[model samples]
Target: MRFRMILLIGTSLMLASFTMPGPTTSPTLDRDLEPVVVAGQQMPSFAGVPLDQLFVYAYSGGTWHQIPWQFDEVQDSTIVSSEDGLLDADDQLVFMVADTGDQASQEAWIADENSRQYPRYEVVVTDPLDPSKRGWVYVYHSATLASSVTQDYVNFDEVQALVTSDRYLLGLMTDHPSMDRLELNGSGVDILDRTKIRAEIQFLGTYTEEDLEASRPAATRDGRVRVVIGSGDLIAYRSMFQNILWIDLTSVPMRVLWGRFSTDLSPTASGSYYYDANTSSGVVVDGVSDSVATSPASDWAQVSGTTGTMVRVVDSTEAGGTPSTYYKDDGAVDPTDTGDQRSYGDAGVRLDDPNRQFTFRTWTYVLPPDQPNVGATYRSYARNPLQAQTNEQYHPDFATAPPTATSTPTETPTAPPSMTPTVTPSATPSATPTPTSAPTDTPTLTATPTHTPTATTTHTPTPTATPTTTASMTPTSTPTDTPTPTVRWRVYLPMLRARGSARNAQNGLVLSACLVLGSTPPRIVAEVGA
Candidate 1:
């Protein structure tokens, strides 16, 4: 017993020593930054009253700390001020409202390692229905300020806390059912146009009366929204908090579900939630529910539900396409698993049902470590397999409404000439051709009219049409022309089941460690045509 104990302790030390450097070791500052706003410079007096009293937090030493890092050693003495309104300060994440004196716009004061202020750098925001009622303020940095623009609407209460990476100011907001992402240029001052930016939402729900009031939306660093529903379900909606179009999930059947998404999508001590397949309910996202892990200490419970059997992960149908599954440790997955469940950079769980016909309409961005500034990306899969029982094809639908002449720019112009860009302007996303045609009615399985009974299916285009291309020019300028961007589409398929065309198998999709359910033949196919 003594020998066994000693061996175990030695192994433990080895593991800890290998992992400690990632989270605890201090990263040397790449360079110094100056604050965005300073005093009496057409910027608000943010240092007054409530602003000065608000506590400041920084992510350093591998954790968020209340104590500020003293930068006296790196402070720069030379200060430069310009009439164009540049305020500089020491390194700090600052929040402030813009100054029109008595009628000011919302803005922030960011200080760098060297105490210099960058002032009057207006923060872009969404516009409101009422022109007089300025929407929520979206704080950005001087570098990317000019290129970013404001929409007509914003939900101030749903704003996510801002986090800074070395070069960007990320504005996180809950666009209700949608997820929102906004970028700030880190190099110089520029204005952001409201028309060029968009927020994406993933889930659909109607806030209960109580939730609508108490359950305000919160933005995540990764561009997703986390909200507490009145039902205590603790739901997350991905998108911007401005110009939110809430989905009424009350009538939708066989809702596509998932286990709780942990911060960084890894297991956490705070615990998580899952969709219960047995009861068609929701349960805690725990280790015990997982199907294949032998280690009790590190296991997460499988999401319970009768519908759980239908939820399976699949493979990507094309090259350079994202793996059917997302895994942790690295992007490489074990090629051995027929289901293609292998280790990847991070892991994500998928939920589906075989009994009820389901469809994957859209996906929203989840939060990541360095977002807004750095940006976040995620993968989504096809509809539930349960829905496939009735309709042989449960793939993603990519068809969108026809592009209206006014919705999309006909010609690429150098900039937005003289016109003030509109807020939350609508764009027409072109439709991707479907196997049959986009489903116009509810999905149902019926015998074919031919004397020979066979599965007669109606195929729907996956929801992949949206403006996702990165804007080439910085958002800071009021351009003389509006450059029309080329649109693209993407979709996700699970790797847990087998069926349909084996061609999908060639894609050789992979999954994460925990998600690796011993290989199962491909049961479902997720198709996305751009």
Candidate 2:
């Protein structure tokens, strides 16, 4: 899920509307947790479907059950529901894979709305990367049962630019490429050391350096966080600085200091541990002390601290593969000042090949630490995402409809032709579900005015590694959760033996009652003819 890296300036003004960017889209988030998003343009067949008559349904347990869905209409940059009730290029369709799968009941050949459960959710890992996995959902245009109710898993606070997911809370920073706050949802453990989580850049032409700040919130959509910023703060002090833009080998959530997962705040309840793509076993990073410049490059990472919770997020770039875990060199800093951190573990990359512009995509997730599956196959799958084959076919209900399953997605997406600055950052309220259940946030798109409009750039120092610290990967164990599998069913008919051995319609589902005689036994039955 590669998306353009953008930044935005935040203001106290709450957005009047929400979710939509200029003509562009962005920021592939929660590959493991976010819902599946399908834009109107991607599915041409949707053009003729009336907005009010549309519905979303996930295939599971052999039948077609109606699921909840929302139609977010777009007017340039902001989201408006049912405004025009049209499925246009500016609009999108989103739904959770949680309620879909290749699983089907033995009688799937005949299951229908009358036999399926309504408002039930299913949890299945349908990542197309797993070659053997079969996963898909359906979008239907119905005249009779278009859902009248839908649920929201993610929420964004337009003014705070804070994204509250099911598992954690993220507050995007406007002053730099870092966060103002990042906390585990229920534990109240703030993962980031808020005082300073910033990105400093180094340009080669003038050999000058400057700190970049967000320009505005660009795109606004659930499961997508986007902001618009330049190589340097384009509106502040360093206005006359060099035009040279250096694509440092890395650029991601360059978090800061002690209060984070480092030595000062390591989780003690169940010991501390971390996981990375570089190794099969979990590394221990129980924050007993500080370390710097850990494994330089790893595609994915997970951590847990005092709350006994495990959280993970990945950072990658088109310019330099996956971003590395590196740090900036700050020669002068207090060893005791937790707020003024100089060297910290950065998920962002430091590009060896500099470029003026490249696609940078990343997102963090707070996985529930309630699972007993640390050794499960999914962890291994995360380290190496394999490719696979898919065959999507609708339930018997839509027997005439074409199969909607798609092929495996490419690791990196080709940016849309119109690079109209993808939307801005995401946000949320403090309350939400765990990361495993999925969460998201979308702000009021770029159509909303920004708080700050300066054009001068800000100063940021060059990034360098601290030679003395230990590897950032530590050895320890963290907690996790395994979601429950949901199976759907309507009626269970017992196999009635007849005539000393033969069975009558082993799968009995009589369409109507046919008994005519009222015997002395005077027995009666229900409508299902059970």
Candidate 3:
């Protein structure tokens, strides 16, 4: 999958605009004019008061700190001079509009009031011409000013635009005081080091007096993965928080090898003769040979040499082709078995056939766990038994050939022939077995037999074995079970799941932010201006 890069440009715009009845007047300043009007009406309770009767305060470090201010007597507006550098970049200036006529009212507001009998307004300042420049001011009634006053310092629209433009975003929202230390300790930043994948990082819902709110309709609302972090143990306050990490894997093309098998004989019949048939009339025909060897010559000699002067013969009358049968000693069968025949059955047949062929096949599929909407492909291969003996490698070619046979023989050899042919029969001229048309290799990517997703912690999932195998070549009378090859790739994606607790929430926030931002303890100090 691919993504388009987002570019952002900053522009300057009008600041705050609120209306209230006041005498129009303009203020005189000592410096060059780049005046930013901070005009707003005072709370109705203090409406009739003169501009000199009201004082403005800035909230910083959890306390309302006072700063020098001047009122615009002409425009009838409040003005804060930026020439003295009182407002720095990225400053969450919480200014309170105080109607303090004396020191008593100021002290009461400083002590932190329980009720909101005072009026206050919050504003976030960012230079439109330089969106990165952060500076802001707020206003509240002197009587209503409290330590616990809700702080609305972050602008949701601005943050969403900034992060989405970069394509990938990761953020943390927590009220934990230990967050700064955790960043330094590498609790979160270390995870990012494990991979080279890059993403944009932003701090959200931090330093605001309000508990983190759930803004579900924001840019991060769709296709977002959330992880809750915290200690499971019970604590006084469950500081639960959320960490969101969004990645676009469409650009990351994952090539997965789905399935593979070598061409070879079936597991039970490999390295052994396919047929052990005898003529209707028992006859030991010497020097009979098959066009092809069923078992190796060494295997046939093992039985013939043991039995005195046993002969090999071929029957050309068979429909497909002449198959080799062997003649052997009568003692090949157990003496207690009364049904056994010494002349015509197992004991006197050819051991190997050269004209026979075998086919082997295996199947597999590839899937993306997180992106289910995206489709995946299936891979498979096939080969004949003889080809499998030499080259065990599987290819994508959809040849109709059988899977390669196992290198190591797994089946036991059948018991040696028990009975000898009673009559010596003449050998008929042998005919070669006609070759059958090869099966067409049809490799299909269809998802037959749905697969289950495997869980893994690593970025790449490990391949596992599947139980499906298809082998063709074994005789119908004597069925053989072939073990299917087990070679398939499985993908496991990373995920975090946790219950919402206050402690966990704080941990989640710090951890999530650190993960996205790639900031260390020292860097975090600069990030939050600590």
In TM-score terms, which candidate is top? 2
The global C-alpha lDDT for each of the candidates, from Candidate 1 onward, is 0.20, 0.32, 0.19
- Tens digits of per-residue lDDT, candidate 2, 1-530, equal 12322222222122311211112111121243433434443333345456776665554443456555555554432243245677774454544434444443222322236222211112222343443453444455445553534454555565676556455665555433334465564566665543232222231111101122323322333422211122111101000110112122111112111111121221222254555555346544533333334465654455545543443333233343323454322324546333434333322334343332333323233455633224223334333332111122233233343423221111111111111121101111011111111111111112122211111110011111111222122111111111111111111112221111111242222222122222332222212111
Candidate 3 lDDT over 135-253, as tens digits, reads 32333334333333233211223232211111112222222111111111112221110101111112211111111121112221111111112110000000111111111111112
TM-score order of candidates, top first: 2, 1, 3
Error of 3 at 284 (Å): 99
What does candidate 3 score in Cα RMSD to the true structure? Answer: 39.4
Q: Compute the lDDT of residue 123 as modeled in candidate 1.
A: 22
Instruction: Give the lowest summed-lDDT range of ten residues in model 1.
Output: 386-395
Model 3, stretches more than 4 Å misplaced? 1-35, 41-53, 75-115, 143-530
**Cα lDDT for residue 361, candidate 3:** 12
What TM-score fits each model? 0.18, 0.48, 0.15
For model 1 the TM-score comes to: 0.18
Model 3 TM:
0.15
